[model samples]
Target chain A: MSDALPPGATLGILGGGQLGRMLAMAAARLGLKTCVFEPAGDCPASHVANHHFRAAFDDAEALTRFADACDVVTFEFENIPTAALDAIERRVPIRPGREALRISQDRLTEKNWLRDLGLAVAPFAPVDDAESLRAALDRIGAPAILKTRRFGYDGKGQARIATPDDAGAALAAMAGAPAILEGHVSFAREISVIGARGLDGAVACFDPGENLHEGGILRTTTLPAALPHARATDAVLIAGRILTALDYVGVLGVELFVTDTGLVVNEIAPRVHNSGHWTQDGATIDQFEQHVRAVAGWPLGDGRRHSDMVMENLIGDDIARLPEIARDPAAAIHLYGKAEARPGRKMGHVNRRTGPAA
Target chain B: MSDALPPGATLGILGGGQLGRMLAMAAARLGLKTCVFEPAGDCPASHVANHHFRAAFDDAEALTRFADACDVVTFEFENIPTAALDAIERRVPIRPGREALRISQDRLTEKNWLRDLGLAVAPFAPVDDAESLRAALDRIGAPAILKTRRFGYDGKGQARIATPDDAGAALAAMAGAPAILEGHVSFAREISVIGARGLDGAVACFDPGENLHEGGILRTTTLPAALPHARATDAVLIAGRILTALDYVGVLGVELFVTDTGLVVNEIAPRVHNSGHWTQDGATIDQFEQHVRAVAGWPLGDGRRHSDMVMENLIGDDIARLPEIARDPAAAIHLYGKAEARPGRKMGHVNRRTGPAA
Candidate 1:
């Protein structure tokens, strides 16, 4: 409580995408100012943030100024440069800390760390080069994903290995970057739990949402995921364990594969997750605000669901359907103020409330 | 729909108070940019707006710049100077139009217009000087209130005349400003209807909320107000008539007195009102977004209430209880980023949801 940042304090954000924009808006709702640090000009977050420090991640002078102006710092993405975090950490504390970032930044590290924590994860092996990739394939088998250990997002920097003969193409796809071979796990459905840990060590989790992806990007997330009472409970418990183990002080999104036997860990995002967008309209408090509260040292808000919701993303040209979507009485639309509708880009989302939460 | 502004278009807002701040955030959520033209430095809306033009209302050069940058302009307050609107209207359209402002800015004019529309209002008469005050007092009777015709809010610019003997003092208190004398109406409770009129001549109104005021400032507004279905329908009908009569565009807050016989119109605000704040948490689409959607020439959003809500204002020193309020599991707190909480100033509000809407 003594370290809690007051309402008027500034929160520095390390990215300027839609996540940062939503985070900035949530911070504003709580009487907190936000300063966004991003290299892109006229980025989404800059539209709402009080200040925009538009400079490269390695620009020490700009980072210093941004850090000096903020009382606490957090990030919307996990891929921020380590040097930038080091510069900010010298001036203000960063919630979720460097440990979560270190582990989640690399796919191999994240998978190994989850396994070491006694969590159920997809069978995986590290791949450094052609030799290691070949050896890992022998153990992990074909029909696996070859993903870069770092800097991969939105299905980027990866190749699918359909058969042993395709290993050459997949290895070439890595382009010399460190990679991981993950054996696919057959699951009934994919679900994610949005959990938060406060500075006081209190944990809260939103109801798990069943997810559907298209082109390796999340397309829709339906709340009150179709799972048995025990399995849902298990999912929440697993998320709580991860948050506690990380000593996390902000919201974390844990994706899980619900198989017949048990829930298997897919991955964990250090910041707010896309699958949790349903909570904005379904829960008492949203993931963005919950993350802000945790990072600011405030008590975590209740993340209880009050409405059954289905959140559908509008990618690129899908924005052309906004006029029709706006006509739906139950739809709550949230569009990022991006200038262009580039293909595969997330332009906005609509959270449609079906009914009261059961 | 043809005249509707695109998502990336700028919506100019006048006055950067909490209402403006919320409106700016809502606009951002809909992928529209906002430029706040406020005289004060570091005002609330500036924190979330895309641009802030900090200049006096009379600054012609600045007004031109602000209006030039916007596709359509709207305001959060009704008392914007006429000259400022004149300059902006020449460049871009202002929603809720000049007629709504002309009527609402003057208490006498508003009452007369409501009455002329075959609606019920408190007995009111124009008061220009001591003679007119005495004459109006004679006609309207004692135990009335003398309020300035323009720029009166939060109980300021008003003086109660308990008896004819208090007339001289109340008249003098006006300081030569044009005034209106209105006889008090005995009512069971105060409630307000938040309604919107879209560019397509469509009308949508939220369920009325019972309001409580202390020291002439609104304290709380509870939804599902203790009114019969018939009376509630009548209230909504009264609001629709006003909107249609004025050809109003954007959201309006119409305060009403629920008398034993029928509902009496108390007053009307051409912009978002304090009593409507509960919509931010309880409704699918809030008043701010509804207002933005209307002014941007988009169709009106559903103003349906999804949950029963009680909105309590944190005025001045009431903000000290924020720490305790933050702990409430059902509370949705919204704070205005004000540097100082002067006496009677609205610092923030908390919306507590009791249950699902009936």
Candidate 2:
């Protein structure tokens, strides 16, 4: 009976991971059932979901069954193949649709879209081979990053080139794939604007959080982020512009490099980002619930924070310290139910809420 | 491996209410598998869980299968039959264990336990027969209540005996069930303490919340409860005592009646209680995760509030208002994925974080 999607409607989730797991949990709190499709068995999302289809993303039969069973589909990761997206769209509504995915799936397109929206992005050029890599390195200069156009995450598929001679090796390392060479921004700090955009064009943004990374893994995000209010406002507006331009209908996280002049768009994650985990314990409505509301065709929630927030990732073997972490009166711990503690894997996170320092 | 139950461990959950549903979601975050055994076919917990055993609680075969699938079994509701607990215990650990359930399942035993623990309780008497009811009525005077000793919840299985003539109707309404008669205290307010107890005897409690009821249904719970610091400590201590006495593991809620004289114990919920829903939005570690930690043998988390809180129930027809509620800048709405919205059913809840009033 809600103006949003009615109860009993199924929400299809693509890529079953901790983000998808949290989103599914939030959706269930609103009378929405979820069917998760992922190739991985015992996916964290599937464990608590209504149903799961454990088939490869490209399996046409499984895709058809998944689309046929769901009313609306959204994804946890932006790297889903366009073929799978196209197939699912024929059967169900795919919010923040295929166009958004296509733009975000490739590094070159994402930078181009941000520039087209009049947002500041680092100088970049597409590099298709060793020849292009050399020319791009000459034009963009040394000490840049070479990232593959697709299927890259968490520092994978990208390499830092400090010398001209490193270009060919970096290109070879990426398997001679379509890649982009981007100039580095010596930013003061990294921050992210976590927000939701509804189909009706409404936008809600949480306060930006200063982020820190260790070995390419997000280590912590602390909020009341060390940014001027004007910069934070600009960051939120930049995110809104991207959402509006793409007709995005769910939560999207925009990573930005805070520079002396202003905020420069770094990259866009079409789904929730690890930086927003603080919202789970620090805000009126967390990013996961906001994403659920957006995809369910419901009204957006307030993204206001009531306290100072810090979310720290429990990576690799850090998970073993959960027992000690649990004793902290100020910390909120969330484990992702992942079985393995291999190197650089994200096992869980903890959020600590504090009053503003005197 | 963790001192707490590790990933791939089977978590046995008793009861199949929305609380269990949420708990299953939380446990899955830690790579835990779940087997939910509830009597209903379409229980809220069954919708997203790994497997569901739809059988009466006393079914031995089903119980054995349930125990076999689970390494540790925790319940959602406290009214589970003791026989079922005995049967399941042969195979798996049942956190909040059988003794806790027995004391909480019956009003008389619960009150006695509270009294024995040196907590103040409303003056109560056992009323198994009409003669005993009359004696209790004469002793306590009018404006009291007669509640069935066992199987009572949400104000069900009880009647107010406002006058001498009303006692007969109240007794008859109880259907000859063994009951307890309690004198009403002129309390200033009602509050509840929600806490978790670990296997290692660590206890953590959220800030108590003031409760409001309408039509015999819990309507709302507001945090930073209208209690002095000493009173809140007393409330938490009462909860800790119950958990310690029962040798309880997992989350437990102790509802309290606040009189001008002091706080009096009202009842105990051996499982997660609705009054604790604020923790889902206001605290660093919500009750669900804490319960998961307890059953999984992990450490209990710090149960401290990060913001002032308000939790409002979405009952039956009220769930239809989710779209509007979702629009509230301050509301974090959550609805159970129940297929139907039956009258008086708890369809969901909305937890809002706000600044404390001046």
Candidate 3:
């Protein structure tokens, strides 16, 4: 609590995507100014941030200048360059810390870390070359997914091996990058928990949301996932355990597979997740504000859900339906202000309240 | 509507206060960019807006530049200079229009207009010199108030006429400015309705909230004001009538005194009102977004209440209690990012949800 930044202090954000934009707005709501560091001009975050430092992450001089301007630093994405983090860490503290980023940055590392923590995770093995790919396939079996060990998101950098004959093409899909083979797990549904940890080590988790994906991209998330009371409590407890383990001081998104036996960890996001977007409309305090509060060393706000909500993403050309969506009284629209609507690009989202929370 | 500004269009704001700041954030939520024109640097709105034009209202060149960047223009305050509005009107339309501002800028003009529209208002008379002041006092009786016709807010530009003998001092307090004397009306409480009208002439009004003022500044606004169902309906209807008469295309605040016989119109504001701040946390659609929707020619959102909320303003030294307030799980804090907490300055506000709406 003694390290708590005052209201007018500056919070530096690493990425200038839609996540950063929403984070900047949330920081502004708490009377904090934000400076965004991104290489591109007119990035979504720059539109709302107090300051924008447009430079490549590898530029040490620009990183120092950006770090010098902020009282505390946080990031919107986990893939920020290690050199940039190293430069900023020398000047100001980064919440969720380097360890959380270190683990979440690579698939192999994240899987090993979760498994070592006694958490149930999908069977996985690392693949650095063709020979290793064959070994991993033999261990994990066919019907596996080969993914780039790093820098993969939104169903990108992934190839499926339907049978033994498909292993060669799946291995070639790696394109000389380090990869990981993950065995498919039979699950009833997918769910995610948005969890937060304060500077004082207090943990809070929002209720799990059931997620639906299309073409390897998230399409919708509905709150109060169909789970028994005990299982719901277990999901929240699992999220809290992870936050406490990392000594995390910001919001984290943990995606889970609700199997017939138990919940299995599919992946974990070090920053705010698209699945948690419903909190903006259904809960008392949203995940963006929760992250800002944690990084700023403020107390964790109440994350109780007040309404049942369904959050649907408006990807790419789906934005053409804005006129009709705008007419829906139940929908709360949020757009990223992107100029082009390329296929699969996340244009915005709409949170529609179904009713009061059960 | 054909005039509807598409997403990514810039909205020009006249004032850079907290209301402007909130408006800029709301516009950003709807995928609209904002450019704020204010004389002061580092104003609240400037922190969130996409652009900040730092120039006085009378600076025609700066006003023109600001207007050139915007598809539509709106204002956060009513006292914007006529020349500035004239310059902007040539390039783009200003929502709520100039007629609303013309009547609201002067007390005498507003009272006359309301009365002519068959609405009940306090007995008022125009006063210029000593002779007129005396005549107004003789007609309106003692225990009245004399206020300057323009540029008055938060109880400034006013003097109490406690008795007939106090008339000379009250007149002198006007500083030779045109004035209006308003007769006192005994009332149980004060309530306000926030209403909006779309470009298509559709009107929507939020639930009225009872207000409490101290030192002539608003302190708190609580939803579900103590009023009969019919009286509340009447209050909302009165506000809709005012908006329809003016052909207003944004939010308007109508203050009413709950008297023994009926509700009396105390004043009308042609912009988002402080009392409506509760809607940010209590309703499905807040006043700021509603105003943005109206001005942008988008469909007006439903203004239905979702939770019971009490919005308390943190004025001046009241900001010192932030630590305690931040610890309250029920409080949703909104700070204006002001560097100094000067006396009587509005630093921020907190909306506390007591429970779900009844």
State the TM-score for model 3: 0.99
Clashes of each: 0, 5, 0
- For A1-358, candidate 2 gives per-residue lDDT tens digits of 1446776788999988989888887788777888999999877788778899999989999999999999899999988877898899988889877888889889999899889889999999999987888889989998999999999888889898988878778988889689999998889999999988876778889889999988777899998888778888999888888888888889999999999988889999989889999887777678987898888778887687777878999988998786577667677667777888898888888888766321
The fnat score for candidate 2 comes to: 0.74
Measured against the true two-chain complex, the DockQ scores of the candidates, in the order shown, are 0.83, 0.61, 0.78
Candidate 1 residue pairs that clash:
none
Using DockQ, rank the candidates from best to worst. Answer: 1, 3, 2
Candidate 3 per-residue lDDT, tens place, B201-315, comes to 9999999999999988999999989999999999999998999999888999999999999999999999999999999888777999999999999999878888888999999
Candidate 2: Cα lDDT at A96? 71
Q: Per-candidate RMSD vs. true structure?
A: 1.0, 2.2, 1.0
* Candidate 1 segments exceeding 4 Å error: none
Off by over 4 Å in 2: A1-3, A356-358, B1-3, B356-358
Q: State the lDDT of candidate 3 residue by residue for A220-269, as single tens digits.
A: 99988999888788789889989999989999999999999999999999
Give the Cα error of residue A120 in candidate 2, in Å: 2.0
| DockQ-better candidate, 1 vs 2 | 1
Which residue runs does candidate 3 get wrong by more than 4 Å?
Answer: none
Candidate number with the higher lDDT (2 or 3): 3
